[model samples]
Target: MLPEGNEMYRSTYEAKKAFKAMGSGYTKIHACVNNCILYRKEYTDMVACATCGKSRWKVVEQKNKIYNNIPAKCLWYLPIITRFKRLFQSKTTAKDLTWHATERMVDVGVLSHPADSPAWAAINDKYPDFASELRNLRLGISANGVDVNRGNRSHSVWPVLTVIYNLPPWLCMKRKFIMLSLLISGTPGNDIDVLLAPLIDDLQLLFDFGVETYNAYAQEHFKLHVVVLWTINDYPALGTLSGCPYSGFQGCAVCGEDTHCINSLNRISRVMMVIEDFYHMITRSEDKRSKEIIVDELDKLQEELCVTLCLLDKHFPPSVFDVMIHLTVHLTREVKLCGPIFFRWMYPFERYMKVIKGNVRNKNRPEECIAEKNVAEETIEFFSQFLKRVDNVDIPPNNHNNCGIHKGVDSSSITDGTPISAAKLVEVSAELFSKAHFFVLQNTSEVLPYIKRHMEFLEHIHPTKQNAHLEQEHSRERELGACRETITETMRWISHGPNKNIIKYDVYAINGYTFRTKAREGKVYQNSGVSVVATDTHISKEVVTYAKNTYYGVLQEIWVLDYHFKRIPIFMCDWVDNRKGVKRDKFGYTLVELKRLGHKGDPFILASQAQQVFYVTDPLDQKMSIVFKTPPKNYKDTYEDVDEEFSTIVPHNDNILPRVDTLDLQKENDYFRNDCHEGKGQNLSTSLCGE
Candidate 1:
């Protein structure tokens, strides 16, 4: 199919050969049918398994099948040391390998990366020799079984992967840095340890005896060392990997002999204390004194957890107590030893598993298919690094990449959305258009002075008019550019307002968030919850009537206005009525009634001024839902002489805990009272109560 002058591979064999030559190769080790042992070292020459007495060759049918002595199963093992050397061969990656030690912002109270955690510090304290070299690597391993064919539950593949913690937080979790160490096919059962023999041997070697490797960045040969810090997996997989009982009376790995259980329940169970809250409480950006106070109180916190668990064990049924419940006790200790659980978790590994599963083209030979495709991808990625001004095939641009203020830039440069069509266009009504124009002007820093002048003139002309009326007259006058005082070129055009032919969008991405209209909320993910902190001020009788409040709303429409030189995006939202539509639960979660829409007159906000939030439906009331603020992803906030005002969006851990009224808690410790109402109650006087 290729042209006569084209230089391309003619067949799959040629392409495979080129890829193998360019990339680090994988080893195919044979295994017994019953998952007894791997055919390596001592077992290499054996015809059958020594333990299970199972044949290593495939059992073939006499009529049609050929009697080739092919191994029943094979484990694809990728050597780690060669991949490590390859990472150092690239100057960009070599410099990034030491970022944990060199470029990390060492804030004592903050946990941005695993390097900021106490576990990393503990390693440094124990091994001064290893810690002396900044280039040394700390790694985390994770393994999980994924079914290649959804139809067949019996056929599974287990992939052992490792993440290099030496890289910065932004780069470490990325798919490029996560390496596939081993691929075990079929049911390994309890013999997973046997399958992991080769990888473990290499790890043991790297730990005890370092390898001499060339650093392309430093341009010198140096001894490289590594340490496997921890393992990330789910409960059952954790048991499979660690050889610990994840279920039953003695399933609590950390508790050991002190594990609490009840015999009444057929299966072992225990209460899971609120462990997430405890961890989130201490994972804040606090001062040295505050951090010290939290650290010193760890024992006290553990004691409180023990007491809470005891209380739960007494009240809750035996069935409510499971292995997951008992695991909560060890979380605080893990926090102290391993830092925040968010840094080292199975979520990223599970996400990467999907990428691995996508490479499987041939179901008959899934292992070989995955290995070959991964090698090809790695080869392509390596070559792309050297090519200038070319997009990497494997690494796509992040959705949250171009976030924050893009001031003085056109909409086409900053905004990403579908191309506007005449069919999707909706003309803005004069009333709504004026309101949206004034709102954009009110929020603009350059137009603030003009607003103050315009408001003062309105108050002077209509002394007897109410603040609300004067504001309405100001909006009407501004649309016609009829202000008594002269304004700047920017303000004049802004006041004159945008084109009436407004373009509508169902979805739009800006300011590090992807926003969808309420019409599109039928989809799986809801991205329509819009919020903005609005300040309303009225100048009357020298009394500045200022009210600042956060308005929660459902995004109804997205409209972009054309001002000839620039296009500004605005969202028309259905704001919930704060008086009747919104209330705070006992846990301080802002719950809103989506059915009760309000704020009809003022419905527009600048896309940049809005912060994304979501609503989780309350189990007790179907009409109400708890509000959750969405944090910006992959955002770097240096805050060093930045021109735009940087709004510090809440960090990942800060919003994990529900706000509670301490006074109410002190009065009554009804932790699990079914009768207690979550809704806020009105203050009633003693006389009114008596009446």
Candidate 2:
């Protein structure tokens, strides 16, 4: 019965002869087939199997044949051998085909490898068409399969024959049918009826046939067929229903329906419109009050609508998934819009109001607080439901949290209950309006008027309040004064006059207890000149002394002698013994005491070196005298030269006399005139000071 001219048939005979010649003890053979070459080794000696009358051979010569040279009669065997190899290799190598085959095989066992069941054999006998068209069968071979080199064989006849005989006709037929079904069902179209009609009919037929077959073979499995049919039909119904309104409806007036249902429909439509409007309001508008109303309405609608839809799901057996999907998408859009709208319309003002209100009202109203807490909890529950619906639809993770809207609300409440306040909320709302109004302020200067208006509004509400909390405000005012003084002093030094001409320096000296004068036209009299007095409160000497003592090195080192000379005494005053108990003889003329007396008598002396000399009226004599020598022709003597000459004739030995080498009083006067014409603390003074 062996095929004629077959190389394997010839090789089998050759192997037997070789074994017999070598005498009987051979037990096994190793064979390798590669690229039309068959390499074989046979055991030449004989052995007996205890369980049966079979004989084994061992230790014969190795044999090889290049399949290309083998007789043409051997070709018939190649396909059979190749088919068996493909079946073995497909298990590891081809996933798509294997998955398709394996899934089907779970219901119907492997077609190529039959089991011991008579039912399977009878089915095989009835369908004798085992071989598939070569084009339809995809072959795969892998190193993981039996006989790794088998794939190298050009024409494996035995495997091809075995596959042709063993292949199941039912599997191939079922595969073809499924592929055809998928092709017909997957066409694209907006009209669901047209797209799905053919698929539904085919699915129905398949359902009936499958049900019949399962009932005959295994009655219990017929229900699974019905379930599969229902699942496939679900998607089609969804598409059809979604497109119905588009195809069947006309204008509302023409589609005459019952007034009650029609009214309900109109209300639902209005809810949708309001939802959409809220989206635009939060995202696009800048009006705070309008946005607030929209947000509140949106919250109410979300709660009512979502609960309504969930209840509808219980009544209708159709896919609620699509409706939930639409609702969730809308909710997600709202959540995303909440943050920017809140920040623009509500957050800042709310935060400011909360700060202004201080928590005093809430402290005594625990019941009201608890009620508000319940509202917040309800809000969180609404958000949770929205999130759950979104999750069921398998929305991408990136869109899940709507960029942290829920987290933002929760954090704002938990960390600081409603961080937004009324004033800041108004400010932010106004900013948003401004942004919407000009968007690109072409003139740019127009922005100034808007800012001025807003600032004026803030002033009206939080106005300076007469500095009623003056002590608390003092440190801020002091810092501001120091900064103004620095700028004025800088301008004075850069100009040609004494710093007294700088209005800020004069004001500072007057406030610091280092300057004094009778008022004329609300200005301090000094050197035949009028200087503006500082409006800032006088800093206490005791506090100043404490500051100097506490931060001695820091304060002393940075106290600019040319600008802030008043700050220097806070450090030096420790050496001044004005106490009556101290012996006047031991301290000599008491320069420290004299210095303190000078500060007390003429605070204007702190303004400039010239002012100090011009206004040092002795308290005892009631007369003013210059201690240093008179100015040179140009008043350009070096500091050391003037100091040496001035030291030769001391006026009062232990008196705190002015140094002769100090800046020329006339030049300093000229500097102040050039620097302080606008006066200090006025808005125009900033221009004079350059900053």
Candidate 3:
């Protein structure tokens, strides 16, 4: 039999080689199995590891006809210069690189993007040479060891993922955009530092001498400036990445101030360390004196961390510090940069783990399967971006269209102009439709007229036949659409008048869900700066939903159409920015900050409103409260213990008396006496004894 790397497979292999040649090539620097120096340049000829004295090859035989295994681990590097230019290959993604400076921060009331910070501007100021060119690129890096088995089984597959912060929010999460710069794999217990040396070396070179690359966004070439902003990971991953003992005593990454408790890692463990986050500490609305006091303390703590991370302190050593901690303090130097802890946090990566997990088809070789899937998806995505209908292709949904959100392409007819409510009613059933119309019970006289006009306008724009054949086809489409998925909003209806019986009408689900059938009741004034009560949030609990402590907000808009074929009392409420409001027990619902809610778009919510009156004391001292339904919950030791006798599963003999029945005469004589029980003399004797 022939060996696997034979000449017959060369043609196929060459094609793959050609394809990979187009991509960034990696440098495979072989290192000793032990923590020895890399075998490169002059050291490449050495047969044994200089530091560890280990053989360079598994087999001593130098000359071989076919196959041989090298006794060394390889450290790989994907060229930064090649990877940087990849961001601009697509025109859509290329333009998004400038979004940080352009569309991010125009209003003074809001600042959400990192570029809006003083740190970004400071970096620009310090590097006047680089900042002279507005096309300078900034990068954020995150690294973690992903177990190929999706937590089902353990396998070493540490992949370092790097993201470009310059991209917009929509494009940032893409697998194609996220570069797999390095892949670290070894036998059981390999110090990550040994693997990271190559990457660190490259990073240093990239920083010292910026890579010269073409800016496709701009017509000319420029020095592509870059910096490793942060390394994001979970607590345990941080411990591994930072070389900090976060799980043990003196473990908190932020403070590193040990509580010295013997029992931790459970029961109010050290893991939940209270870190008055730098951003939170600075943003709080406090007095000047208080602010100064906080700033003074934070400054001291920051310096302590810096000193500790540098291993300059007498107590600390290089072994205790890792690259993550040293780079973390860099954020403290400039306020514009999100704190080191926050910038490269693992939230996005954690979410992306699901995407990676989904790509795995073969459990035996999950890494290979995921690599193939990721490449295929990225390749398809790259080609799809070049064509039109990018939205459908970019966020490639499931093969089946069962998405809770409407599946139809967004159109002006679905939700176009703001609908005006009618003041009075007028008969319009006769004017708009023939006797064959399906619209029954118009909300009001004026509402009917508006509906009629809207229907006429809709028919003029999207004309449809009233014939039985077309009506059947339309009915079939509506049936399939409704049955396939739950339609939340009526405005986004694909077909007007589902069938012949209820159609020839005007407004579809245009009006929001409401129980009230009358036009007067449907007149919900929803516009900018209108006060309203809202009880809709991601964290809303059944207990809090029952409480009348609904958030007060300015009205955004209220759709007049019925929602989901039911008149639900639903309307959109814009969040009001009020500092004077009292803080109620949210029961875990975090208060939505005005700036965080949305910077440009005024945050609004569509919720079902109820007449839940919350009576309060006035100057006159009046008192009243609305009826509320008690939330259902498990009786978790909250209920009083029942009496011991009744608590048992089987009924107690003392509590339950013996059951008895009245005896009846069976003979035609119709008299029951002791003498009649001759056959059972014991019963007769017992009866006589009783008498």
* Highest TM-score against the true fold, candidate: 1
User: Over 4 Å off in model 1, which ranges?
Assistant: 1-6, 33-37, 48-56, 59-69, 149-153, 212-222, 265-307, 387-396, 402-426, 451-496, 538-542, 595-598, 616-625, 633-691
- Rank candidates by lDDT, best first: 1, 3, 2
Clashes of 3: 23
**Residues 481-582 of candidate 2: C-alpha lDDT, one tens digit per residue:** 123343444333322212221111111121111222222113444322212212333345223222211000000000112122221110111112224311
lDDT tens digits by residue: candidate 1, 135-225 = 8889999999988873344468899999899986667777888899999986577889889999999888887888988899999998888
Worst 10 residues of 1 by lDDT: 682-691
lDDT of 1 at 431: 87
Global lDDT of each candidate: 0.71, 0.25, 0.43
lDDT of 3 by residue, 1-691 (tens): 6887765436846644643554534566676767466777667888788888876665445654322355446555555556566556766566788877665534332233455555566777887786665555666667665656634767656666777766554455555567666655443133667667766766776667766666566666666666665666666667777777765545556545422223322332122111223333333211122111122333443443432322222233323333233334434433334522234557667656666567668776565555655544545555676687565333544311112222222222222222233212223343232211222223223234444554455456556544343333332331222232533344333124322221111111221211122123333531122223433322222122222234433333333233224322123334434443323222311132322222113232222222211122232322211112111111111112222211111211211111111332224223332232212434321221111
Error of 3 at 476 (Å): 41
For candidate 2, give the lDDT of residue 368: 29
The window of 10 residues in a row where model 3 has the poorest summed lDDT is 629-638
**Ten contiguous residues with the weakest lDDT in model 2:** 550-559
Candidate 2, superposed: residue stretches over 4 Å from native: 1-198, 211-224, 228-243, 247-303, 306-691
Q: What RMSD does model 3 have? A: 26.1
Give the clashing residue pairs of candidate 1, or none.
269-321, 270-321
C-alpha lDDT of residue 584 in model 1: 79
Q: What global local distance difference test value does model 3 have?
A: 0.43
